[model samples]
Target: MDIHFIKENIPLYVEAAGLTVRIALIGILCAFLVGLFCSMIRYLKVPILKGMVQGYIELSRNTPLLIQLYFLYFGLPKIGILFSSEQCAIIGLAFQGGSYMAEAFRSGLESVSKVQKDTGLSLGMTEKQVLQYVVLPQAISTSVPVFCANVIFLIKETSVFSAVALADLMFVTKDLIGIYYKTDEALWMLVIAYLLLLLPISILSSVLERKVRYAGFGNTSTVSGK
Candidate 1:
């Protein structure tokens, strides 16, 4: 292991780790917004809009993210649509994450039960109002465990963004290995750096899951906090 090399390049690793996190945080945020809107479209079964959303979700979920990134970063130029590598990576990741999130949310939303929706209607609440006031909050809460897992997975998956020339941790680690020819040391560093990024997220997910369990999302007595 090149301990001396790692020591000297500490600042580089730090910057790269920071970039990885920024990309993940922003990517997940964008993904959530996309998922939310798409889930609503599917839930409401909006005619033309739902078809578009379904195709997007299907394609994003089925295709490899690398292929999507390559298409966005490389293929788009063929059509005169140009985006920076950073933009392509971020957008591709966001769209991919959004597909899975949409399904999670859709399941959560529908899990609120038919009786609950009827009850809301009996109380003179419109369908949209029922969703806004009753369904969506519970859906978000119930979906947290899955959502958290997806967030962490998305963070790890950002490693592939290195392929697109993003200066994320994986990219920097690869750069270091290339420059120093210390594959073992660089990989060890990569593992530790990724643990630093993912461990806290795992712990937080557990805590949130526990809270949700105590909330009894599927029970009649417990109401959604959101």
Candidate 2:
């Protein structure tokens, strides 16, 4: 309950929080790209690719994220594909989030009517153009809430990177507790920092969900809210 201790360690928390946000943002962006690619492959039903994408989605969905992180951080070195702890943390978080994102996005894509696709074709648009112009926009607008939810989950999961000494907020909080022997102060600061970090994201998610639904893209339950 020492307010002084928490105040003194404010700079450390700020730095740690910055690192955490950086990692989480990078992971979120990468996961979205990965998810988009996965959804496209499955939607297109390319001969060999659809099967591979399905297997990847299933495997990632079923596995523990910790094991996935361990595989990237530890197992890669044995194959000479070395990565630092932070790098592995980013990659693993992105990969683990991507599977869930894939399913969400794929469902969004499919929710767009067959009539929409047919209309795009009747307008003399190429298949690629139809997807780019019609399908992806609606799909993304529809999937925003789910994507935001997954981003929040990914941010929380970044705490696991502490096990690899990635120096994120949770890692720095642990360090503060050990160094100062002030568990209450450090934990309080940790909780506050996370609250500050997550609050705006939650607010924006709600706002965006309403906007997207009102825009006539995501009102259906196919794009379920969290």
Candidate 3:
């Protein structure tokens, strides 16, 4: 599979992979914050804010990341707004990912029963305390699988960063294939690069899930601190 060619291009792939990871990590972090805010709004049923969040979630979730990237990179400049390719990639990833994260978090938050919240309140736990101690813990535990999946999905979505001219892994692979006609070698490296990036996260998620279970996050008795 052109081992020499692959070896020679290792540095190029590494640089691209680094850029991809940096952008994905920043975007995912921003998305989680956005999702957390939206999920809280939905969970509490905030009036005007809740509706806005709903619309945003719908818009973000329905549109493709490539479309969002195009709008940010191309459409915005036409209207006097401008961003660099890196900025566009990050924004698009966050925009697309926030909705999915919101759903995951909202579902987790909702799974914490009203009865449990009431029980926490009855025990003299303040509302904030109840949320901090009771609701959030259980919700996070319940949502781990979904949250991890969203993280992986968002990272993979970085493949579209090339649409904005970012030198991400996909961009490098395509560039190599086009320039050298080394399709098989480039494709194999691309798959290996992605596996290197994603496999640890998948493994870590499984470990985290087990840790959550053992830590008694969802256990009723643990919730009550008994």
Candidate 4:
């Protein structure tokens, strides 16, 4: 373990980590929007869109993120479509994360009782209003823990960004190992960098989950509609 090498390379890893986090944050935000849209389509049972969303979720979830990034970064350029390495990284992360986010959101949506929607409707709320005011709020509250988990998962997935030529933390670590042969030091730094990135999010997720559970958002029983 070369303490001198690790100290000198700290800035390099910091820069790489920053890039990794930025790309992951953007990708996760896009994924949440995509997931929300797809889940809403599924929940509403939209005719053609429901099937399309299901297929997309199946395809995205089943495929590896590396394959997705390869297609975006390498394959697309061959066909006249082009994306920078960063763009490909972001898109691939979002594409992979969206399906999982959709499932999490759909699970939350389904946990809201049909009777809850009906009760809101009975109160003279329109279907839209019922969904907006009654269902979505509770659904989102119920989904918070899952959302936190997904955020962490998506962030970790950024490790694969190296495949597309992004200078993420993993990329820096691998590069250093290849060039300097300081595998142990580079790996230690990688582990420490990832721990710095993930531990807070993990702890925060637990805190959020406990808070959500204590609030009893989705834990109550409701009468089943015949």
**Best model per lDDT:** 4
Q: For each candidate, C-alpha RMSD in Å?
A: 3.1, 1.6, 3.8, 3.3
For 1-226, candidate 4 gives per-residue lDDT tens digits of 7899999999999999999889988999999999999999998899998999999999999999999999999999999999999889888888899998898887778888888898999999998999899999888777787788889889988898888888889889989999999999999999999999999999998898777665445453331111
C-alpha lDDT (0 to 100) for residue 209 of candidate 1? 81
lDDT of 3 by residue, 1-226 (tens): 8999999999999999999989999999999999998998998789999999999999999999999999999999999999999989888888899999999887778668888899999999999999899999888877877888899889888888888888888889899989999999999999999999999998998788667666444443333200
- Candidate 2 regions exceeding 4 Å error are 217-222
Task: Write the residue-wise lDDT of candidate 1 on 92-201 in tens digits.
Answer: 88999999889878877766888878889999999889989888887787777778888988988888988888887888888878987888888888889888889999
TM-score quality measure for candidate 4: 0.94
| Clash pairs (backbone) in predicted model 3 | none
Residue 117 CA displacement from its true place in model 1, Å: 1.2
Model 2 agreement with the true structure over 1-226: per-residue lDDT tens digits:
8877777889999999999998888888898889988998988888898898889899998998888888887888899999998788888887898898998898788778888899999999999999999888888777778888888888888888887768888888788778878888888888999999999999998888888886554346655654
In candidate 3, where is summed lDDT lowest over 10 consecutive residues?
217-226
Q: Give the candidate order by descending lDDT.
A: 4, 3, 2, 1
**Model with the higher lDDT, candidate 1 or 2:** 2
- lDDT of model 4, residue 122: 90
Pairs that clash in candidate 2: none
User: What is the Cα-based lDDT of residue 21 in candidate 1?
Assistant: 83
TM-score of each: 0.93, 0.94, 0.93, 0.94
